[model samples]
Target chain A: MAGKQQQRLPREVRERQMIDAAVRVFSQVGYHTASVEEIAGAAGISKPMVYIYLGSKERLFTACIHREADRVVETVRAAVHPDEPPELGLWSGLRVFFRFVADNRDSWTVLYQHARTQGEPFAKEVRAARNRVIAEITAMVVAGTRMPGGERIVSERDAEILARIAIGAADSLSDWLLEHPDESPDSLVDRVTDLALVGVERYNTGDLPPS
Target chain B: MAGKQQQRLPREVRERQMIDAAVRVFSQVGYHTASVEEIAGAAGISKPMVYIYLGSKERLFTACIHREADRVVETVRAAVHPDEPPELGLWSGLRVFFRFVADNRDSWTVLYQHARTQGEPFAKEVRAARNRVIAEITAMVVAGTRMPGGERIVSERDAEILARIAIGAADSLSDWLLEHPDESPDSLVDRVTDLALVGVERYNTGDLPPS
Candidate 1:
């Protein structure tokens, strides 16, 4: 019966289980501190099985990073509605990003901290993912600037800078949220979105009127 | 006379040499990748002497962090004249920060990336040093808002967020500059400060005019 039950689960299911276990271990102990034995134990399998399924530790880590980053990008992309104004789309995207991070803190840590330091290929993978998001943000800013009767304010170069600045603000706030785990993700998102949009609103407005 | 010829240098001089060596090693290889032997070798000293002088690798890291943080804070603080308006103060401080990162990229990387990841004590050390700089920024933001007779704009909480955003943007840009090494520090500072100040100025203006 045990052999039949093990056979019933597909290879994909087992692979996911291994990846989940790898993410948890990598996030908790970081890449170097984490070991194959611990990950296998966490996955409820033998070390040899992990090697067989994932090929190697480095491969396993790469797999985890790909999955986590894809999850984040998909969630953020799904939150944006094509018909919606750029501001609303961006706000929704930011909300999704915060909620994703809050729900999957471990996965986010694995992708951002662990993968970033594992050397070239993995770092490039993560950077490509980040750049994709940044590019989408740049597009949104460029679109948002074309409101009817509104003067063309920020140049493309400045718009790119604005997108990076927005991402930076959100990333920093997320880091702050990580330290203060007691804070609810909803309230944190509200504060972060407001602060971020306020900066955007400021950028759209060319001059500061005399107070 | 021959036996007494080998005299140890003064403690301060030796400490500086150790820190300089440490910054080079830590920034190059990261925390876990660097070894005490490498540090001592870089300093042209015996491993035993490094241990005797700086205690352990951990203590030596702490000392290096303190020294760099102090230099960063002092440089920014000295750049601004207190009598200048808050906006100018912030601009000058930003300029100083950019120049400092340009001149001492290694020191900045060691403090920001390597020390930040090692654990709580070192992270706290960096955070404390960072908050001191952030607090000064917060003060400037609060003061700048008061000039316009605007409705209590830029709250203490928002000011803190802004400070984090500003510093994070600078740090991310500095990291970006690592890849684009040909970019001049002055041009980078000019562009970033322009983006930041425009955001600040727009906030003081009551309405978010779509421009």
Candidate 2:
């Protein structure tokens, strides 16, 4: 019965378990210091099994990056509804993104901080993920530019620029979010919104007193 | 007479020449593929002398990163005048920054794109340079928040957030600038400013029609 139960698990399920363990181990020990044995042990599988399943440590790390990047993209996409306004969609996406990072700090560290500095293949993977996110956001921004009256006030180039700003701000702020553990993701969003409002008001009114 | 002239050159001048050559080589061939012998040849020095001056290829790359980072920071700082309003100061700094990256494409590639992905000692240097830039921009934002009436509309925290946005946007847009050779730095800045103006206009009037 036990042997049958072990054999019943699918390859996909086993791979998921291995990746989940790999992320935690990689995040904690880092890429160079982490070993396949430890990862296998964390996954409750044999070392040779890990090698057979993922091929090698490098490949395993790449898998982890892809999985985490997909999860983040999906999370942000899920939070944004097409029926909503672009700004609201952006706000929702940002909130969820912060929450995702906060909730999965280990994944964030491994996927972002570690993978980026690991060089070569891993850095390429990270760049690919970033480009994917950028493309999605650019599409959203373009869609937002068209008004209910069908008037497009913003150009496609401008939409791309705004999307860059939004993504960049979100990326930078996520680092800030991780550093400031006491701040909730929602609170950080509020702070950013408030600051933008104040900046807009100041810019328009030209009321900035000379310091 | 030639030997005497070469010997008369100061250590600082020799080191500078080596670094200038190293940046060119590193940027062209990357860190691993670049050879110290090649750098020495480019600098009009012997390979043995290159080793004696810069210790190793790693240290030579480090020197290149430092010098380039310093040049960028200095260029941006010089463009921003203390008497100018914060927005104008930011605009000037951004303009100079884009120009610098546009003007020094190889340096940008070596300092930013390459140094970041080369792993440890090099990655640390890149982070340090980034932190320095962030700190300077944060100070500028904080100063901007204080009005001539001595009233502060934005908090220090908010100021830091704005600085992050500025730096992140600049960093991301610089990549876009590099990718599109036809776009001038001035044109990019104008597009960004115009987008901000339109965004501000739309946000204030709540005139965004639901699509």
Candidate 3:
């Protein structure tokens, strides 16, 4: 902005603003081109404060990755009930996943787009968050495959692959959602859940092709 | 090593070198930090030659995307026969997709990773590549769902969603393959096709859960 107007804000609030600005800049120009000065300017603070508050660019990016990943993991983790039907659990998890992406496009970009591709510092952090979510989904999937008396149909390994496919579908759909803003999470929840679970069930039953 | 060594090569050979250098640099440092000079240096040529041969970094990146995208599409398209059973077509296509990524890791990174994340100059090009392949797979999916007399079990739209799921699975698995280098493409082709096609079959054959 014009001449980096010094807004006298509390340290906590200022840090939030800096992080928010960094998300926008990093999402827009990506990690390499996004400068601390530009982020500070966008936050209406000085460059030194960005360094003081968030440390180096590497640290700033790491901060963004951690923050966004935590929010996504928290949002998704809080939504599903392990006790419910597994497909239902997947439906809830996917509903939250898409809702989270729709609401936080910048964070989505930061987490899914920019951060994953930024090499080691961001890669390790992003992968940890991803593996955690995938594991949770895998558990829900395993739960879902149980019959009325709790007889397991799909194997754990098969369930894990199905869970990853569902996650990948949601991830790709989330990217598609960015392009088509009006699409709602509820609409997608049914389509994706139906498409994925139907296939999983068929696989669990007699759907495997002649071997 | 000391000075810029001029490789007086043919236009075709020089362009190939430049694109190879680009794939390495862009994958290493990412699009924003990957400079034209760095690409030229990696190619063992000077800056102006890179410009003359590839036009601009933007064009060079576009070239890389097209080249890699073309290679992937050609490989997969050549592998799967449309007249074959749809699931088998999918199996063959995925086998080639994973094998291509395994053999050409840098090209895989450039096409799948860097090309997608870099904004609009590359977005349209990358999206075109993705949509083209998705469309091809969608057709194979539609073909796979045909009945004995050619009546279809899965509708066109349903097949498209399933195709996207399969593509998403392959994309995610390709990323997984990066971490597990020893894993064979054949092993994954079996698993992914089983998970995806079985679900589609159940969905088509009235395998819906009791309401």
Candidate lDDT values, in order: 0.74, 0.85, 0.76
Off by over 4 Å in 1: A1-9, A24-47, A56-58, A81-89, A109-128, A139-159, A181-186, A189-211, B1-9, B21-48, B56-62, B80-88, B109-111, B114-128, B139-152, B193-211
TM-score of each: 0.71, 0.92, 0.69
Task: Provide backbone clash counts, one per model.
Answer: 0, 2, 2
Q: Model 3 over residues B13-126: C-alpha lDDT tens digits?
A: 888888888888887887778899999999999999888888898898898888788888999999988777666677788788999999988667766676665456676787
In candidate 1, which residue pairs clash? none
Q: Write the per-residue lDDT of candidate 1 for residues A75-193, one digit (tens) a residue.
A: 98898876665556656876778788888887787677656554556877777887888888778767666558776555666667666766776677677667778876677666655
Off by over 4 Å in 3: A1-51, A56-62, A85-87, A106-111, A114-125, A139-160, A194-211, B1-52, B55-62, B109-111, B114-125, B142-160, B193-211
What's the best-to-worst order under TM-score?
A: 2, 1, 3
Fnat of candidates, each listed: 0.24, 0.53, 0.24
Best by DockQ: 2
Model 2, position A171, has a per-residue lDDT of: 84
Query: Which interface RMSD does candidate 2 score?
Result: 4.8
Q: Is candidate 1 or 3 superior in lDDT? A: 3
After the best TM-score superposition of candidate 3, give how far the Cα of residue B98 lies from its true spot, in angstroms. 1.6
RMSD in order of candidates? 6.5, 4.0, 8.2
